[model samples]
Target: MSFVKALIATWHLSILIMFHLSRMRDLKSFYLGYIKRHCQQDFPKQLSYNRFVERQTSVGVYLLLFLNLRCLGPCTGISFIDSTPLRACHIKRAHQHRSLKGWAQTGKSTLGWFYGFKLHLVINDRGEIITFRITHGATDDREPLKSEAFTNKLFGKLVADRGYISQDLFERLFIDDIHMITKRKRNMKNSLMHLHDKVLLRKRALIESVNDQLKNICQIEHTRHRSINNFCSNLLAGLIAYQALEKKPSLDLEHVVSTLKRA
Candidate 1:
């Protein structure tokens, strides 16, 4: 069973590499060869790299699952959303000129600040990612909500931070029957958040942890792609790689069962 799992897992990684390195034939060939050497199975020799990526096949199905799978039992009708900065490198490279130069910018983060794009992720109560959108640093967190990437998500209540709260956004989501749950900003006068909302808002922290896992564990945003095409290639590859690593929803079965019981 372990061997079967490993084979299945490695195949998915191979697909991701194909996607990311597609633009750089040399890198793609080299990395695929590296995988073949490590696996001792000549995985790359089994198929044309371009054809394999185009087919998508099982890998494409899994991407769908990542965005639309239902929890094993019942959904809490809750979702969490957040965004993280993806810097190509230090700010020193800002004016050096690159393909993605106009597509990213310096943005404020909890770590002080950084220059680059932001990857927005939306996850469910069970911690399964439902949707993702990459945006310019100057793009507002709420802007992606208008994107088809997120507007089409199959969810109910969305939990986010103050950056995502706006009267227009709330109204827009409400039209889709998805309620927006976020902390009230100091400058705005609105109805007080319910005690339950406050409690659920705390769970929003899970998305941040997920961001950390993507960067530190999956190395998604740690690339130095010199061109915008390469940057997008790496970003999509990272998403694919993370999906491959995600065996089940982030929650343990015990916790999932407990949440279901409470719901």
Candidate 2:
């Protein structure tokens, strides 16, 4: 296929994947039962399931990343950051899994230990994603904040869970003019927090709701991926799908703004 034709094919396949994910349909069934009949006019030529998968996987991560970025909602200065595990396979099959052999790792969360990657995400109080990064499960939550590239456009207060509470990380973000607010660990010293900050911290559950929507509504987590490329493609598609939702969890920004102003 010509370069332009290949690009179009990739884009069309991505749309199909997003459609599949958003509707929670079986991938193969969606392709055969719906896309082949209803979407035939869009394709230059018909493609078999295996060929379609091959072409879609070749579309590269950069394209999907671009699409994800394009769908991002505006930053509201108030942002929430969190990470969730993306398990590659059943723990029983971890030793036999080779598709993500070098890419995935074992990591522990509040729920427990799992073997896979971790998706670090930042979303505005509007419940729209600002940016995201994926890392090995073993990677520290505070590590991403160290990169200027990641925190470049992020400003105002960034809220996260206690896993992100580190004195060094807090100082680094403070130097960059981005205030880091996180819940204190039980053993840590009790420093006074602003009333505004404390209220926003109470609403950190908004991000958790976002995570639940991504996993359950958008189907970001699945063990049926056959290749790392497919795994990433599915994930990016799910993120894009979530972006298309008409309603999302959001904070009462008007109240937050007024409260901060009064204080």
Candidate 3:
């Protein structure tokens, strides 16, 4: 029956999420040694690890829906934006890497060249994810911002690092009533900013911290992916897992704002 199939799909999705949250890093060992040997009651009927992986692509839609409908937080006007590199493999291994060969590309970050994709994120002052996009490693950081739908829910001040400095992008977001704030490059000329804007810029590290949790805690990035589809499935499950976390990196905007005014 369709209902039975749906239930199985949900069960499979849960297991994938558990793998990301679990201390075990290897999905095979987690599914076989942990779930199969110990959690039989939790998953009464289970497929072999190979079969489950082959069909995990089925739950991809549900993962996206849950993240959009449940995990994502409301845009709170004040936001921080940044991008982090997701290296599929070391640059030295790019030539021989085949699993993500076509999907992932060689891209360079401040940390140096990496062979992978870029995850662009926008988070609010309370450190909740507002919007996110994944692009090939070579994609421009400013490309996603050009999409109206990508930033439709956002407004007010958006803080970013020096890498996001672009006049055209700034004017584009300005037209949408979303002001983009970034640290002025040493050679560039921009007028003095307001006290509130300057104070918020100091908190740009909040986005970087969020990125850290996504990689280190959620375990979104790893070099062990064998299939491109599973690679995506793992990523979505990781983001969903992050939403379940009780505490996330955040800012004390009220106190900071009041203190800035007093100064």
lDDT winner: 3
On residues 1-263, what C-alpha lDDT tens digit does candidate 3 reach at each position?
A: 99999999999999989987885777899999999999889899989999988888889898988898989988898999999999999999999999987899999999999999999999998889899999999998888999987999899999988888888899989999999998888788768888888888888899889999999888999998878887888899998888788899998978787979798
Arrange candidates by TM-score, descending.
3, 2, 1
Off by over 4 Å in 3: none
Model 2: ten consecutive residues of lowest lDDT: 16-25
**RMSD in Å for candidate 2, one decimal?**
2.3
TM per candidate comes to 0.70, 0.91, 0.96
In the predicted model 1, the residue pairs found to clash are: none
Model 2, CA-based lDDT: 0.82
Instruction: For residues 95-138, write the lDDT of model 2, one tens digit per residue.
Output: 89888898889888888888999999999988998888889999
Which 10-residue window in model 1 sums to the lowest lDDT? 66-75
| Best of the candidates, TM-score | 3
Evaluated at residue 241, the lDDT of candidate 1 is: 52
**For residues 26-131, could you state the per-residue lDDT of candidate 1 as single tens digits?**
4446446755456446463444555544333445444434334532123356778888999866776677747567777888766766788889888776666677
Task: List the global CA lDDT of all models.
Answer: 0.65, 0.82, 0.90
The deviation in Å at residue 176 for candidate 3 is: 1.1
